[model samples]
Target: MPDIREENKDIINCVLESMQGFVVTDLDGKIIFLNDRYADILQVDRHEVIGKDVIDVIPGTRMHIVARTGREEMGSLFKLKNGESVLVNRIPVRKNGKIIGVAAFGSLSMLDEMSTVATIQKIGHLSQELNQYKSELNKLRGAKYSLDQIIGNSPNLIKMKELIKKVAQTKSTVLITGETGTGKELVAHAIHQLSTRSHHSFGRLNCAAIPNDLLESELFGYEEGAFTGAKKGGKIGKFELANCGTLLLDEINQMPLYFQSKLLRVIQEKEIERVGGNKPIDIDVRLIFTTNRNLLDMVHQDSFREDLYYRINVMSIEVPPLRTRVDDIPFLVEHFISKINKELGLNITGIDDKVIELFQTYYWPGNIREMENTIERAANLALQGKLTLELFEHFLLRKEKERSRNENEICLETVRFKAEKETIIRVLAQTNANVSMAAKLLKINRSVLYEKIKKYDIRTM
Candidate 1:
């Protein structure tokens, strides 16, 4: 028995309440109307909330302010009393184009609730993936050497460690100069491990390992389509990747002269422009440059830039050659023996006294690298729990003989070359120059035999 207008109003109310949760407030900041959905979202009884201050009913509601200001906020994140976040629209209601009240429409329907939950779970999954990626990246680029890994306690070693400690406290560029195999990169790693930025990345690039044409791209990165065969999606350069971290450029003397100017500008400007890109990105990187060659001499000879040399020489550390630190030879020997034992799974206790004497007397031209190789060889041959003098004496005698022969220009290499040439000639003649048969007989690859034939100038027919 209800009239048509009353039935239409009821239908409209039911439709609006089912589709969205909404609350209305008057200019006096009093809640005038709210659906059951809105009341449930606020966790309050619908009847009691009517005529109450909107702020009191909903702790952080802005409906009352919107009613007075006649402003609209769409798709804003509104936190509910239960710590749930919902997207809401706070819209002002106008009568005859004059502000009257405000309505807040919230995403509180069942569909919206499910969507919000899904979004939260997606964000959590992405966060976990990001953290895992960062862990792997740290392992790849992190510093692997600490001060204790230097392994010597001689006066020179102690002096060098002290210098490392002092320099690690600053942010200045470091230049580490030393002979090849003297562990210059180890010093660079130690400085990074002790510095304030130890918790961040430590990136290293060997200038000599990269070709001259590709060094710039490796250091500064390149954009997609920067050149033929460029990697897609561009690449992050060393400076950008090592931002707020340390970057070590080993064998910097091998960097081409043309690229040195570019590197100088980057050091001075603290920014780099990717190849095929116009914008210069800022970088905060601590630089450590290492070189075996004397950079100052190169500068004087015009092979290296004087400006670049002075700029990088701000704080220099000269790692002494192993010969000068022979006082620490015993310690070095013990360390190498223990390391080799672990690697080879051998229980060799130690080296004999005569072996240590020989090690101290020998001029190690190859430095620690050569010493390590020698120790590993000895450890492989050692028996009865010790490295004896006999284990290394023959190796030393052969090395001495080789050095003498080299000085007289009659080394084993010449003898072997002559013998190999004669053998190849004999095999070619025996086989009637059938390359495959000759290669099989000599136990060498066919291509190798062909190269030797070409070198020896043997007639095939």
Candidate 2:
């Protein structure tokens, strides 16, 4: 009988050694035995793991249903601290039908899998293939649009382009003011791409999107246990992620007044203090801000900080609305059509002359974004060859009626006269209020220019 018991013990030990992962815990959940394979899976020594509470070594074990119920459990997925995924099986260890303890046999791999090396190699190969496919897809998408992609023949646009290029070469803070959908974000990206820090990170945040309460933490990371439900380890914020690079604050006007002081301090001191943290960390970052709202109005209303506004408006660039740059409509239309074709896989070639004429005549209240959407819809519905006027009649006619109503509501002739007045004022200011130079720049006779300037209430600075 003694020889039989020794043989049984030897067989049990052999079975545990040959198994992938085996752990024997007492009824109280103290790990009394651990096989070599079990220690290898956790990357720990088997002797050290023995006699320790299973919950202490593997906290996930405490949540196992088998710990509550004495019945056997199988094929449970377990996650480790190191981000490893494993499969486990827990069975009740009984003697003479009396439950003594629990024995867990787990395999990191799925059922019918052999070794971890084979599973890891398979996952690595799949990841490589997926990345290759994504690269190919992105290449096929081609270049969509950027600041450099905007084409125009107007002198105003040319000067604006030059200013953008010059500012792109510097690290100075830039403020871009424009109406909604006027491509302020695009200009910001162009500046970052052209700067010396182009190789580094380019981060963007919409001041309007984040809540005021969370904005501080989002901009400056918090330490572990900084607040309730905080992450176990600390998290890095966008500002820190963009250190040594560029950070674009889109819709800067929407930033809360309370946070304006914090932003100004970071800009002035080049340092930031994380939320709930005492220490200050220095950062090297170029700041760019964009807003569609009239910041001067906000400053007057005390909705925005005057000092912060001036600090960020060191180099202001105002993007003209599409209405003011009507001459660029043809180029913009063609670009949108091509973009739509590539994105939606449509082969639209050209628009009819009548449609182009109607497009030029219509006033685009929503600017370039509206035009792009119209073109995309037309392209999706049009036949393969050419886009006809009838295909865009609904959108075109609607815009034309709107334009007519606007002209009637605000006396078209009077508005044009006022526009001419403003143009003269701007041209004279640019030419130092010299009539001869302003006339030459405006391509008009000096006498006629003087008569028009006097006819309207145009004043020179």
Which residue pairs clash within candidate 1?
none
Cα RMSD to the true fold for all candidates: 23.6, 20.3
Clashes of each: 0, 0
Model 2 segments more than 4 A misplaced = 1-147, 404-461
Worst lDDT run of 10 residues, candidate 2, spans 137-146
**Model 1 over residues 1-461: C-alpha lDDT tens digits?**
77999999999899768745788888788888888877777789988989999899888777875775567977655667666666678999889999888888875433446677786556556767988997787688888888998988889899999999999978999999999889999999999988878768999999999999988888899999999999999998888888999999999999999999999999999999999899999999999999999997677457899899989998999998988999888988888888887778888898889888877777677789888988888788874388888889666885687567666676666888899999988988898889899989998767667767887786788
Which model scores highest in TM-score? 1
TM-score of 1: 0.59
CA lDDT, candidate 2, residue 347? 88
Instruction: Report how far residue 171 has shifted in candidate 1, in Å.
Output: 0.6
lDDT of each: 0.85, 0.79
Name the TM-score of candidate 2. 0.58
